[model samples]
Target: MDGLQAYGAGKAGGAFDPVTFFQQPHAILRIINWLFSVVIFGCIANEGYINRPTEEQEYCIFNQNANACNYAVFMGCVCFLCCSGLLALDVRFPQISGVKDRKKAVLADLGVSAFWAFMWFVGFCFLANQWQASKPEDNPLKEGGDAARAAITFSFFSIFSWGAQSFLAFQRYKLGADTAIFGDYADPGQEADQGPYSAFPGETVESPPAGGVDGTAGSPVGYQRQEY
Candidate 1:
């Protein structure tokens, strides 16, 4: 509840503080994701290339085949950029602070999170499969083998990381929904702008008269007047 209140306050034009931002679990996870993606990108782009098969074996071969490595590098770059952008937005914009904005942000996060999870799963599988299929016969020695393996491993790890993010996003989305309809995280008396019975602004409510219906100053309780 405190978290939700803080989030609402932040959305309502509260000053954004870096210390508070980093305290959130989501921020930590995103930072880790971005750093891991950068590592994977470096490995695949720098050390995951191999010589391409040609009719004549040249002493110095300029051709290279990096099919699986290419895909991994692409995924890494995309994920890295996305995570960085999200981090910046969290600090500057933080649309998730408000209930309505939170719903939209959660939906966007769900789609992006699911997409990244699938991409990571596919990337690791393809890289591993290609690495296995390209095994050499006698005295097998592969170039960039360590980097390729590392990239594949990180890709696999990213699947669960992204899945966990999706789970958190889904929970936040539900919270947004509940807040919209039932004021779940709001204060006890005030309903945080939800529900039908809202206290409107500047609308005055009149109190009942001190005198009874018959204008008697000291009318007893439940007194009734008889008409002729």
Candidate 2:
């Protein structure tokens, strides 16, 4: 079955729909992140070249802060690819069957999500702070000022986008934690056993007979009682 049926994601048809795809929060965030990545990458890349002066020094040399902005662009590209891969995975394998494996996946997602959030926050701050701090003596008219500002603005947007993803991952982690504590979350690959709770709909424990084989009280007729 497809992911929608496998995971019971929705009641609609299992077939893919563009409108439904964009409706989900995770998918929305992924698309937004992807767009932000592209925008930031373009701005930073453009700024790096556009701001370069024709004089003795290059653009980066003219604006030392541009280096940090370039690094942000690199990270944006990486985040973009990561977002794409995650989106594809979500669409293809929406639900993981095994409990243990699912928990591991959730934890990994949480870690990666948090890492990206921190990276984006720090990157945005670093770029913005560096840009604002640097005061160049040469006041070039077309020093990619607009591109740099756009990159910084989109960098901020990316921070929130990644933060939202991280928050969602954390919520998933919390749900997994609750399931581990009180529910029957088991790995299908492992041998099944009676967990801490009884089977659903209730179960009954069979009681042995009161009489014993030796005419003693409280012993069953299955075998001789141990003296130890």
Candidate 3:
């Protein structure tokens, strides 16, 4: 039963272990996701805008498409925040005693991870397309080319990392479901009620007849005739 306990069903107030926590596959992926989001948003925020000598206003470097740059930056920021929140939740997960609560948490993780993964995919494609279509004349100096490429690369990596998180969450959900089902079926109260050798209720064993061998209240017929 110890081996079969559902994830996040551990006793509360356990001591935290940083080494073990970071060693987990899911934790490692989360850290990677966090880093990727930082790289994407950091690059775009700092170097995504450029100003032409002729124009007074700054413009987005991705083909001058503000939407492209905005989309990537927005998604990246959201991912970074979400990763931080999820990491905190992961740290507290094992202390959750309620199965339903744990389930809700895992489901939230799954949905969020999946949603972010899709968003990153979209952002990567949008940014890359805009970059590819950019005219050399727009920025002849190529000031933010490296930054734009870095953002796009990290966005692409983020898609896979978030997808992996979703997969891990799904696995945890399934494991918990299986453990709950088996636990219900193995309940001691149910087993006691259905004991193998127990008789049905209200049934009684029959007693032998009170009188003679012929099953009558009087003496045997042969013995009575001899006395007479």
Off by over 4 Å in 2: 1-19, 51-57, 136-139, 185-228
Quote the lDDT for 164 in model 3: 94
Best by lDDT: 3
Question: Each candidate: what lDDT?
Answer: 0.68, 0.67, 0.84
Reference-based lDDT, residue 46, model 3: 95
For model 3 the local lDDT of residue 135 reads 97
RMSD of 2: 8.0
Cα lDDT tens digits for candidate 3, 45-130: 99999988878798999999999888878888988899999999989887776677788999999999999999888888999999
Name the weakest run of 10 consecutive residues (lDDT summed) in model 2.
1-10
* Ranking of predictions according to lDDT: 3, 1, 2
User: How many clashes in each candidate?
Assistant: 0, 0, 0
lDDT of 3 at 100: 77
Give the least accurate 10-residue stretch of model 3, judged by summed lDDT.
Answer: 201-210
lDDT for each residue of candidate 2 in 16-43, tens digit (9 for 90 to 100)? 6778777988788989988988888887
Model 3: CA > 4 A from native:
1-4, 187-228
User: Model 3: number of clashes?
Assistant: 0
